[model samples]
Target chain A: MPHDTAAHDTAARDTAARDTALPGAVAPGTAAGPAPVPAAADDGEQSLARLEAGLDALESAAVSDRRPWWRIVLSRLLPPAVALAAIVLVWDVLVWAHVRSGEIMLPGPGDVWNSLVAEWGPSRIGAAVWDSVYRAAIGFTASVLIGTVLGLLIARIAPLRAAVQPLLSGLQNLPSVAWVPIGIIWFGVSPATIYTVVLLGAVPSIAVGLIDGLDRVPPIYLRVGRNLGARGLDSVRFVLIPAALPGYVSGMKQGWAFAWRSLMAAELIAISPQLGPGVGQVMKFAQENLDLPLALGSIIIILIIGIGINQLFFAPLERRLLRTRGLSRS
Target chain B: MTLTIDEAAQARTLTETAVRLTGVTKRFGKQTGTPVLDGIDLAVAPGEFVCLLGASGCGKSTLLNLIAGLDPVSSGSIEVSGGRAALMFQESALFPWLTAAGNIELALRLRGVDKARRRTEAERLLRLVRLEGAAKKRAHELSGGMRQRVALARALAQQAAVLLMDEPFAALDAITRDVLHGELTALWQETGVTVLFVTHNVREAVRLGQRVVMLSSRPGRVAREWRVDIPQPRRIEDADVAELAREITDELHREITRHGRVGVDKGASGHAS
Candidate 1:
């Protein structure tokens, strides 16, 4: 294909020469002057090539090779595993030292594990996890859709951005859990209340993320895009959005976290027979029943799910995005 | 070949003026303030390599921006015989997300080149810039010189008759800049693209351009113009280039001194000593 294109370029040069009577018609590699120094030019070219090669060799970065899969997995998991073990050990020592009178107040890791095995077995926990995960997925998807539109509107429109940007930041700081009272009043313990709370929590961060990303797109990219004939929506599509991907991805990650937290809060407070069993609902029930082991176990499960989602989904995505742009070391 | 012939014909029919700026003025804010570019008139012929030389604050970059249509002139008209001019900045400005070829390909793709032909065209352009080996390399992975070469290739991929370069080699090291000067000359000769190169370096202007234009600072106006009769493949160290660079540098110093307010006598006498 390159050969074909090279031939085409040569042919074009020939035709350009024959067609144009101007001085520019002089063929490539042939000097424009009558008395041309071919030998000197050749030496110059050789040295130029040599100099360029040396500079490239000296300056061009060597992209480091990735670690082996097992090593990567071990490096990622080992620290957290050790941290969890240390945490459990601390909790056990506290329990042994009579930090609390009984299991109702503070259960040891063993009691929590035993309770988890007896009552919250795989099937029960799986059902609870799926219910919460499903709600979170739906709420987050809606938040993303709404937030993207809102973000684009805010980022592009000056008046809207000026009017709403400060408010959006304030909204991000407001706890999504605080919306539960109003949500219950408005929707009365329905799935809509849960989703509404999740959306309230996630949307602000996503929108703010996109706005920040758009804001940080280097001005040079826009000039280059304009120079390349990218105008209006084409500029945004080809240049602005892609340049802003890192920020947007980070924003979405934060949005997902917010959504997860909001879902848990909503489920914990809005517990009822109508709503199916979820991790948050289980925690609430365990709390009401004064089952410290189940409550602690549920908290651990929530933490695990959050970390798992971030590691398995968002981490890899952000890593790949950064890696491709040569922004990441690993 | 057909594209080149068509462009050449287009240039000829347009009366040999590849780029013309008449009474071009650009101001940043209020109309009361001194304009960055004040009633500047410049004409570049087809396939001419014209270097715009200036001191700092002379708006050398602003002039290129006006020609490239990145910014609107506050007043006056600028015309290009061909379509939009392709621009290269001092910074390579290559998209970090894209590889070297990908950057060129984006230019091609944005120019409405179909997907199937864009890759081949991009590769050919990289080859033209002698960067075939660095095609798959991302912008951050490549050296500064390599990135600039890719930028030049990407500019070429626009296939605009007029190429506006705003101090494109200003950031490169001495040796790399020298090598690129030769490369740019060769590419200009081969492609017959009209170049409006902006630079503050007198030697660079002399080394590359067929015509060197000097602009005075404090509301940049054309101070002087020199038609460089030096032949092609002129080095920065060439006697003719150095001689011309000396003359231009002296003129530039005088132009800069004109704006001096305090310690002018002391500075002049100190320099004389």
Candidate 2:
């Protein structure tokens, strides 16, 4: 018993001296030292080995099995539906509580629905939607062409990047609504005014998006491309552009939002008989007439259209790009 | 006398040499640090597999880049007889956005192959790498070994006389690496492309190469060379390979130790002790 006690004491002293000699070596338990150190290292190695094995197994399994189709559909569909239902329920409760009595002040869901059915006919609504969509399409298309070229120039040319990069960032943050008055003053409440507003609002983000994407591309890719004899325009077209696609696509999505918002702002502010009524103009007309249900219905329509276009067009493109690049988790 | 004899032999084989470098020196900047490669002279014969073995900070990769024309040599002349050389990195360097076929196709297209031939040629190369089924698979979808094989296929698509590889299979698992070594040897035999492979692993160099050249780091220079006349299909764990690796590793250790002493980095040696 005496010998055992002496050996234990010696071990304790040795541990303490070691701990003092090398600080922070023993992490959690300073009291239990040398004995635990080897054990911890062994444990760490085992875990690392296990983790490596697991990853290998996962990589092999990943080759055969794909993300299930049903899971994709459910993920896309279920949450949005539930959220929409909850919103409708809350809106109904507010209306029942008489928060603001009368259709002019706050319209109930049924009232909005009735007003949409009665006042806004299919043909009239279609024309309004067409007007807004056509204007947005033209503006967004122009923005994309100009923005892409400008972005490529800025990304490649150092002096241009230095000069324009800060201005683009500033413009991206500036609300498109602020451009409506200037646009009207310049174009005098014509279709040109709306186009000008959309261009001003959307171009900055698209150009910036391309620049950001190009900047993030690894230098190794360019080196590899050059080694393969892809020089100048070919390198830019094949290597830089494809590598920068994800960022560019995201920037385009943001640009679309800016374009859509600017078009609406322009339409609302610069309502003209010659310009024809758009969804935004419909809302303006509703507001002037104090028809809250019509206004709410028009807003609902606008929201649905925006969400629909994104889900149908931009989302798929973005998802496909990310999937091919192996950037997506699923 | 030995250097003259070696040069005489090299001169006799000059007509068949796929790649030749004379007095190659690479400096990063004007006077910031010592030159990475100092007076490097290397000659690669047609269809020969040469492994460049070195420790960390060796200019092995830099040497490959110079041969591949990815970077210009600071002072020497490099002659690659076969058009531009194709290079494969430690990483697959495959475009993640491209499918295996697409990746190969791009190389073919860049090499001036017509549109009609790209698909068939890409398929042929994929079959060469024994990855026929994976031609349509995206880089992310394939296993690491498969990706490397695809990368190899893409290199093959270049149809260059020489292939420059920078530790291409170092990232793979032991089993995968072994499998790739076999595939590479077989492909090398079939394709008959001159290969200048760079690696730090002694056994891997001995196993894969007809000749192993060791480079010492810190102003990288050729320290030693061994002609491994070992027969084909040599295993990484073979007795002969292990024996050669042990000898080379000892030499490598000596070189490292010499460098350590010369550098006089007291803190580094102290930590080791």
Model 2, span B1-273: residue lDDT tens: 999999988766655789888999998867556789998888888888999999988899999998998878899899887557999998888898889999999999998999999998887777556566567788888788778888899888988889999999999998778767876875676567889999999999999998999998988999999988777646788999999999999999999887867578754755654
Model 1 misplaced regions, further than 4 Å: A1-43, A61-66, A93-104, A121-123, B1-15, B261-273
TM-score of 1: 0.88
DockQ category of candidate 2: incorrect
Q: Which ten residues in a row have the lowest lDDT in candidate 1 chain A?
A: A24-33
Which residue segments of model 2 deviate by more than 4 Å? Answer: A1-59, A66-71, A101-104, A122-124, B1-14, B265-273
Q: Whole-model lDDT for model 2 versus the true structure? A: 0.83
Q: How displaced is residue B53 in candidate 1, in Å?
A: 0.5
Q: Best lDDT goes to which candidate?
A: 1
Cα displacement (angstroms), candidate 2, residue A324, comes to 1.6
User: What is the lDDT, from 0 to 100, of the residue A230 in candidate 2?
Assistant: 96
Instruction: Please give me the DockQ of candidate 1 compared with the native complex.
Output: 0.37
- On DockQ, the leading prediction is 1
Highest-scoring model, TM-score? 1
Candidate 2 residue B159 C-alpha distance from true site, Å: 0.6
lDDT of 2 at A51: 37
- lDDT (CA) per prediction: 0.85, 0.83
